[model samples]
Target: MADIAQTRAAPLRHSTAGALAGLSLAMLVSSLGTSIANVALPTLSAAFAASFPAVQWVVLAYLLAITALIVSVGRLGDVVGRRLLLIAGLTLFSAASFAAALAPSLAMLIAARAVQGLGAAVMMALTIALVGETVPKQRTGSAMGLLGTMSAIGTALGPSLGGVLIAALGWRSIFLINAALGAVALLAAWRFLPGDKGSGIDRAEAKGAARFDMLGTLLLAATLAAYALAMTMGRGHFGGLNMALLGGAIVGAALFVVAEAKVASPLVKLALLLRDPVLAPSLAMNALVSTVMMATLVVGPFFLSRALGLGDAATGAVMSIGPVVSAFCGIIAGRVVDRLGAAAMIMAGLVLMVAGCVALAVLPGVFGVVGYVAAIILLTPGYQLFQAANNTAVMADVDSSERGVVSGMLSLSRNLGLVTGTAVMGAVFAFAVGTKDVATAAPVAVAGGMVFTFAAATGLVALAVAIAVAGRRGRIA
Candidate 1:
């Protein structure tokens, strides 16, 4: 890992409460924008007369682009400058959002959304990285905790708010709202963020002009792109084609790994990933958590709306209840992590996640006041624990020089995991539908979901217990 440095640090000053508040708001704006759009997909589909399959692409495209690019751009921020990218990202996001609002066709909306995703990538990559640069290290966890809370709130509020917005205005109003929020975030970044000469930026431009391995990046990009396209095309109609594409993507990913292994300053530095014990565990955690989180996403809507017979508003409210609690609980979890260490915090989280999933998996048709809902609330705290604790461990383990790559790898793991989790849940649902006890199909699907998530959580718990029992002082985390 190459260290990028600024010759001088900005003058030390504790940012005002107002500035911190502004930063949290920026996070909320971005979180709300994405969450709101996802929840409103049904309305958009009806408005555009889109096939269910095609409408999926609209949501998937944004997720794919954001997942693929966030890590790369985040590393670029460390190489160049966080502030420059922060402002540029907001500007591009706002412009794209405005354009999306006016898109007259589905094709246009998809393209515009991909661009919006690119901007979001930049923002996600830099947001926490920028906070590290701006705030003193001591208060960093608290700041990040609040950001997580906002994200949870946005996610919880998304469906209900999106439904209201679409009912009152139109589907386009979601993008319109994104435009306004982006503007505010832009202003906050410009006015409150500290200034410094972007590290490694001018250096890259000088002398012989060193190049980051664009080829390696492009190869990996194609791997993800092809895979996402295959996923979008999945089903009996294109099952054969999906298989072919999946095969090609697997080969591309293999080649990418080979190329990264050969290069000194590889696009991702796969060597670091292999050599560091800390990094290895972190990556595993990332992949597992993503798989669990997205599996719930796949199953939650069906359980709430179809099985529970809840309307969109009620579905949103009930489904989001866990997230609402998780949001505030993240702060407390972070503090617990500080006191007890990552190992303890992580173990507790994984255990809760399993317990939560078990409840839902075995849930009866009727809610016993807190039976179904309590499971969701239980699931929420664990999510907070996973995000707040593992992230801290990752940061603490890796050197600042390699932070960009670390962030990128984590981001990639998360996105790919979402796709994989969704696939697993889809498979489980399809299988359950074929059973004789078909009326209880949803619960069976829920049980299958718990099986996958618990497996993931179980793996993490095993690792956490090992660390706790052995007292392994790892280098990478």
Candidate 2:
């Protein structure tokens, strides 16, 4: 009788765990689609006879729409109901994927991709918010670990899977595959995932959110768009207007930040990050690391294929090693952090990333895929370690009421950093190469980008080290 009672009680303890797992699966599907499309871009470009600027929009459209919408959509879920948003997002994403798969022109494809981005924003919002709510405070680290592992796998598999599909069918197959997975996720979420009606929504969740900040959204969107365009257009050497737009982006972003700080129920809690104990270091470190990692991901594929003279299949295969290793190592990083504390893990991970970037930057141009693959494997472990630990640290410091906002801010930092990193690094590499043949120009481009990454990694590690040294004790997972 006692044993049976304990067994039954176990479910009560982990009721939210199952929901988290379902949410994790949803993240994997969406993230995989993002990267998988990258590997297929060259093939799509060839087939469409698309210009370089136009081909790039396939990615930019998704990034722009997703980044702009994440905070608004996520906070809305907290205000309304997470489950409602989840269902709506899945439906819209599925429809968009179908259209993307059948897109007859680049313009139509960009539109479809934007719709897909909107859906992705919802999924991103829900996944972390669900973990924060469902998992007990003590077990949140492990829950986040599990979520991070799945997302890492999706990131790694996307390129390789896309390569196979593109080779077997055509570029259309990549988008179609996403549609199929979205369908699967929709079914799974509907069946296995519990309703968020009485879950993930608390008294403090986005109270008084009816007054959405329209002007703030517009200014921020314009800034983000203009900035992204500046970076992308600068690749071929910028016109005067592009530079002017870049300057405007700087001004717009400043205005939005100031506006957000003063508004009642601001669109983003820019002030909270300043006032909160947990968020300052955690968010800063996460944002810095994210910028480096995202830039690496964007440029690494192009470098692997072009610099080392590898093909799509081989490049994807090599890229898979990092995420595959991350899946395994992430577990260990989580456990180590739980026992030894996050500061150590943060330092170690940052060190590894610096080393990895330096190696890739300095590696001989002729080392081929082996050296490239090895460097990425080193990079992934650091990324996963930081991701899990950072989330744990941030959530540990804040009250439960603040988790939704914190998660949204954390995710926004990551997405915006990634979008910026990729665009900037990619354009830098493109400029370095100067339209020379990939074989001749790629080495220089890769070196320049990796140098930037190495510098960024060093700067991030310096911040983590400083924080570690400055404090006596902090909330640890």
Candidate 3:
């Protein structure tokens, strides 16, 4: 078997710049799609003459599909080839975008968006995997930082871009624009990315590709779908259905564990997740930090608009401060991680997040926009630093043949964090405000809720710090 040292010496097929550009473009487009659709919700509701709950399915469907399929798709990329999977994914995404733009009914549009989500999942799972393959070990941190920056930019621009496009060219224009951008990304990927023929996976593993664990894949998909449904709908009506779905998720998880242990080729490597010291802790930190980051993103806009008396434009501007800081800080973090190693950066990031959350919780009203901006400055850079360093650490010990599945695992952790954070934080905010409808709540109520929710979020970040510290102690012992 080829060892980590041997794999590290494997020559990349493309220049670092070329590979980074191709992969970063893919990352940007996928990340952009996640939030771009949000701005069009009102427009879509009007166009479909659908209720708000029904229209929300357009977004929910996409997120659910991506979350459910990302792991399976990443595993597939490992067996087949990441390059091939990425090309196929980009093509599918573009085609879906076009279909969505042309859809005459809400149902069709939702279906198209779901397909688009599948494509995005493929891209998301492979973005870091491909980067790991293409860049040398010494430069992996910087490359990850670049990818992180692109994601920040994409997310930061999504709402503003969507609003502009919707006003100027209508809601369909958003998808249409994505279709065009996707086409360009596809071409660049094809032209720049290395072919699958000599990609990083070991020859022996490729030979065993036919032994793919279909049952494990299905179980994982079912688990993720059930969990996502439970979380998304649990806060609303249908308590009975939510309970059933949660129960199904628990069953699916147990069955998946059994199936993985027996399968010749498991969809996810149970040992890596459960026993590998390095990977286990890194993944845990990833999920926890992601939760903190996501919670802030979910709650930030509400605080700005309600508590700060900002309009849409000002709220957007204030909200963008984090991503903008992240863009520059991500680059710096990459280099820092490469020099100082991932552990220090990860610890520093968690500390910053804890401090930032505390500041936001305590100082929001006292310092006003300055406090919000200050908190964001700390939080965004902390997130970027943690992500770049943690990703490097996770992939550092993974075998080349296992990069695909491991990458999938990493992406899955992030998706889980995002969903969990959004649900939990929103619930906390709703509870604090004493109403499910926060948007309609009084400004004073919203301000109070913001403080309480941010304080709760601070506790979550503190927990992440504890986990990181425990992981470090375990490693030292």
lDDT values for all models = 0.68, 0.70, 0.84
lDDT tens digits by residue: candidate 3, 289-394 = 7777776777787778887889988987887788789878888999989999988888888888888888888777789989888878877888888899889888
Query: What is candidate 3's CA lDDT for residue 179?
Result: 91
Candidate 2 lDDT (Cα, 0 to 1)? 0.70
The C-alpha TM-scores of every prediction are: 0.85, 0.81, 0.92
Which regions in candidate 2 have their CA more than 4 angstroms from the true location?
1-17, 46-49, 192-194, 197-210, 236-241, 298-317, 358-375, 397-401, 423-456, 467-477
Q: Which has the higher TM-score value, candidate number 2 or candidate number 3?
A: 3
Instruction: State the displacement of the C-alpha of residue 104, model 2, in Å, after optimal TM-score superposition.
Output: 4.1
**Top candidate by TM-score:** 3
Choose 1 or 3, whichever is better by TM-score.
Answer: 3
- Assess the local accuracy of residue 431 in candidate 2 as a C-alpha lDDT between 0 and 100: 54
Candidate 3, superposed: residue stretches over 4 Å from native: 1-13, 197-209, 234-238, 440-445
